[model samples]
Target: MLYGAMKVSVGAGLKVVFRPRVEGREHVPARGPAILASNHLSFSDSFFLPAVLDRKVTFIAKAEYFTSPGVKGRLTAAFFRGVGQLPVDRSGARGAGEAAVRSGLEVLERGELFGIYPEGTRSPDGRLYRGRPGGLARVALASGAPVIPVAMIGTDEVQPPGKLVPKVLRPGIRFGEPLDFARYRGMEGDRFILRSVTDQVMYAIMRLSGQEYVDVYATVAKRQLAEEARARKRKSAQE
Candidate 1:
């Protein structure tokens, strides 16, 4: 299979180059469906997490990664497909979250691993952000899959924002014990239950990652940080 071949080739090289240190891999079920809820730190989080796992962990990616213009776009699409990424249109449609939940539920229905970043986006400042209580909780409760809190360490340092070449450093991954929310099953429609489940999973990730917890969403934090940078620049120009 293409997935196996790509994983072997790329995963082998990644191990040789980055030499990532993985812990509690046994926390992952040897069989059956599970949700890998991880803190979003770096773009490489997608590749690195899959590379180290024995089973394929499919993540819902933006549709743009699959559809674009030119040769680079084609290659990007191919790579994402080769690695088993499911694309969902995220262009301000209310259905975007619904589509992602559907995709995740489908993957779980097949009894496979489904990976999700509860933070919704990469941490703007290397700190853990509040988990979005939408797709993650909906899919988990609907499918009754065990949610595993995974932590990726040092990935940002190895591959920081806008960096072309990754630094040679030993990143780490830690998998916490599965957080079972079976009690919340059939209650996915309850917003309060969704928030509770998402918060519990986020707390587990925070403990495993040891990153400072921010009570805000990553997107809001990113925007505020950008505004602060612009204000500083304007002040400097005026001076």
Candidate 2:
């Protein structure tokens, strides 16, 4: 209700000035369980995609959002939840990946749509990073749901980093066909197997969207810097 209504009113108004062209919306399933996997470009991409998507797609969100302090935090949390976001900590214990996959699987098992950013986090470089494979393979193998590869062009320019408000700019969303991974269904849990399936899905997105691929997990690179920061703090305390 809130999503569709907001999209209709706000989206229409926005389009009058800065129109956003959407393509391949037929790719999104009108109903049933499917994965809307997209490349992470900008923060606004979250609201933008959901606004354009006809269905009530649920995306995996960080758990910290819910626990945020003060009124501002409360509003932010409310809006995200109101828009159908599920909380899952992506930076906690080693089991974070498994937990998120499990959450998404639960949604699928209930015959609901699940959304995920395969790259794990936003791409600072505008280049699609190598996905973590995070349970995408296992989930597909388990649920038998079709994966819809989505690509958002001009989003980065619409709302770049360090900008609070979106520039009165317009960007477009180009959705691709839903891809079936039934051929690899019978394959065992081999790393190579998972990587191949992930790449194939990403390739579909890459072809439709035409973004540069990074071949490295965005989370892994962030993890390195985070670890270094922690180590530095520890050394400072000890010295």
Candidate 3:
């Protein structure tokens, strides 16, 4: 009920204001379970993608969003839940990945759309990063649902990293055709198969979004960037 209400009210309002250019929306299955594997560019990627879609799309968010203390935390938790987000503990990579896969599978079992960022984290730069195969691959293989590659174009411009408020930029969304991995149905545990499937999805997203592909994980890229910044600072001080 809350999700529907928000979709109609808040979602509708944002659509009117932003007026995002959406393409290939018809590619999304009108009914049944499917996985939306998208490139995560900005925090708003979550909101913008679901806002334009007809069916409810659920994404797994960090547990902190739901577990924060006090009034602000409560409100944040409520808002995320209202927007069809499930909270997953992200302390341990393996455990968190497993938990996310479980949540995604549950959503798919209910015959609803599940949204995932195959890249694992938001891109530090606009370049698309290597995808993490564990959650997305496991869920799709387990659920036997078609995976759709979605691209959220120009979202980073609207709300870049570390920005609180979004600018009035014309973001665009592109949905590629569904990718069927029925042949690898029972190979969920196979790491090689998972990587192959994830790479294919990422490649499709790259084509749709037209972002330069980076072969490293987003988290790694972020770390490298921070290291570079520290190095520059040290060099400046020495000079």
Candidate 4:
């Protein structure tokens, strides 16, 4: 109820004011288990999807957002929990993939919506990087749920890196047709097969978003860049 309502109200407002257009909304199931596979561009990408979606799609958030220690923490926790966000430890300590897959499948079994960023992390340079066959394929295979490919474009401009507050820039969301791996129905636990399915879903998102696609995971590139920048700064200071 809150998810659908927020999506309609906020999404409509953005459309009227900022002219952010959303396509393929019909792809969203009115009720039933489904996966929202999208490209990770901006943090606002998380906010905007629920605001515009008709169904309540529950997202898994970072542990910090749910574990903060004050008024801000309380507010953040309340807001995220209210919006149906769950926190999962992404540090991948133990049984990381299995844990997330279990959580996602449980939600699907309960006939609820689950959201995932296939790229695993945000695109470092505003480009759609490769997909990590994270438990997404497992969840889909386990629940037989259709993965809905979503693309959020220009949200980076709305909330760029290092920005404390969001600027009122136009943002657009496009939902591609839901991807079903019915063909691979009995093939769970096959890493190679799961990766192939993920690639097809990601290709759909890349086409919808028009961002250049990188063959490697987005986070890997971001980490390397950060290291290189730090090294360059150190050398410059010495010079």
Among the numbered candidates, top TM-score falls to 3
Which ranges of candidate 3 are over 4 A from the true structure?
none
- Give lDDT: candidate 2, residue 34: 91
The models' CA-based lDDT, in order, is 0.93, 0.79, 0.95, 0.83
* Winner on TM-score (1 vs 4): 1
Winner of 2 and 3 under TM-score: 3
Indicate the residue-level lDDT of 83 in model 4.
Answer: 70
Better of 3 and 4 by lDDT: 3
lDDT (10s digit) by residue, model 3, range 200-219: 99999999999999999999
What does candidate 4's lDDT look like per residue over 1-239, in tens digits? 65455566665776566666778889899999999999988887877887676667788888789999999998888777767788887677356666678889888988988988988878889998988786778788778999998999888888887786878877888988888898887687798988998899889999899989889988789999999999999999999
lDDT of 1 by residue, 1-239 (tens): 87788788888889899999999999999889999999988888888999888999899999999998899999889888878799999987568899999999999999999999999999988999999999899999999999999999999999998787889999999999999999989999999999999999999999999999999999999999999999999999999
TM-score of each: 0.98, 0.84, 0.99, 0.91
Positional deviation of residue 59's Cα in model 3 after best superposition, in angstroms? 0.1
Clash numbers, per candidate:
0, 0, 0, 2
Q: What shift in Å separates residue 61 of candidate 3 from its native position after superposition? A: 0.3
